[model samples]
Target chain A: MNDPAPKTVPLDDKDFRDQLVAIIPPLRAFARGLCGTRDMADDMVQDAMTRAWAARQSYAAGSNFRAWMFMILRNHYYTTLRKNARMVSWDPEVAERVLVAGPTQQDGLNVQDVQKALQKLPAEQREVLLLIGANGVSYEEAADIMGCAIGTIKSRLARGRVALTALIDGPAYKDEPSDKGSRSPAISPAG
Target chain B: MHPQDSITMPEETVPERGLKSVKETVIASDDPIGKALRRLHDEVVAEPIPEEFLRLLGEIERKLNGAVTPE
Candidate 1:
């Protein structure tokens, strides 16, 4: 017969709340990367933080804090807004037109184009792209954080890049008009 | 903390000269995405963590110290 595992020191509510607060910055940063707007992400994270704090006993000590917290926040985000409502614009009819709109064919690659293009990507693809490409998170880490397979992360990253490239090359993205002598020198992509 | 917080350009190539004119010559680098990517990165750096977030963090901290509820 095996003995029951030794007990550890119990965390009072205050200690648990402190732990949740400490993780907020990175949590907020990650949430921001997912939701596309600061206000929504903060709201999502705050709700998750509250939920986690209230259910503190469920979170085992010495576990993956970032991953656990992220799961809760993400769940809150999804539950609050279903995919359809979120994809639509404030103008009800605009959502229909927006669906068929691909990247404009002649915008010329620029940051503005990229941002616009990214907005069109599916939420999953966007999440993977932000986590892996912009934020420099590892595939395994993202997979763990997202509760998906590493292969899924790689696939989303590839697809997201392709979609973004198409948007950059499309006509909708307008290049910033620059004067002959005043345009800033282009920096290398390698940088 | 928004989803687009770090959204950046595709990347570009830069010449030795810091002058804006030099930017006209370089596009993406061998890496192909560096130019746009770097600019976006700079933008992210420029964005301070939103004050509302800081306020919330402060509030949470206070709650931990027995100062208030989730306000």
Candidate 2:
């Protein structure tokens, strides 16, 4: 528990409402990473928010509200996954339109490429990467959110990083000797 | 309490492999993968909350108010 000791609080507390409102952005981000499409992600967030509001009485004040919310969203994501066996594939066309076209191109790894690689990862590893690497959640908080030990979180994160690196740098984009003359540079120079 | 209160974990086992070697390769914040992940997440976080969400929250608040007040 990264949060302090829990205490009882009113369900209608203004601060609770404000915190719920404030968490929507990150919640969407987390969902987007979990589900490959923006529409699906937003839908998941909406569902999570409704569930959280209904279960507001279960929330313990002074504890980590963010972690608690994340746990709810995470549980919902997995449950949805089980119910729907067909995973949503990443849409490159939508990615091109929504993602910022700048910085990512500079590093030779565009946002679309990264997202595509991310979708390849196993669900457990993917969530660990998103929670720790993207969302900046600590090991303890991540464990709590994922219902696993901190050691498990660490192992998953390491494997995820390694696997993601392999995918990005794999033969998919590598220049082949036979086609070297005809192939364009893997990355265009920054403007 | 934890939000796992209303939810149940599905019976699934995540494979643990190469634990020792992989743990040693813990990613640094400056790593390209880390940077890309952060960029992807930050991009979404930067987006404006959709109107539907605001409407949903408003509906919930209204219901809460209705529940608290006698008819």
DockQ for every prediction shown = 0.07, 0.20
lDDT of 2 by residue, A43-144 (tens): 989998888777777676556777877777888888889888666455567665545443365564566677877877777778878887888777777777
Residue-by-residue lDDT tens digits, candidate 1, B1-71:
42222222211111111111111112234333333433333344345556775776677676667744455
Per-residue lDDT of candidate 1, residues A1-191 (tens digit): 99996554335666666677667766665565465455666677777776776666666555555566766766666555564366313333332232222333232345434444555666666666655555455566666655666555555565566555666666553322111122222222223
Clashes found in each candidate (C-alpha, N, C closer than 3 A)? 41, 0
Judged by TM-score, which candidate is best? 2
lDDT of 1 at A166: 60
Overall lDDT per candidate, in order of appearance: 0.51, 0.69
- Whole-model alpha-carbon lDDT for candidate 1: 0.51
What candidate 2 keeps of the native contacts, as a fraction, is 0.30
Residue pairs of candidate 2 with colliding backbone atoms: none
**What stretches of model 2 exceed 4 Å from their correct place?**
A1-11, A91-103, A171-191, B1-27, B68-71
Q: What are the runs in model 1 whose C-alpha is more than 4 Å off?
A: A2-25, A87-109, A171-191, B1-46, B67-71
Put down candidate 2 lDDT per residue, B1-71, tens digits, no spaces. Answer: 43322223544322111111111122365467777888888889888889999999899778767768575
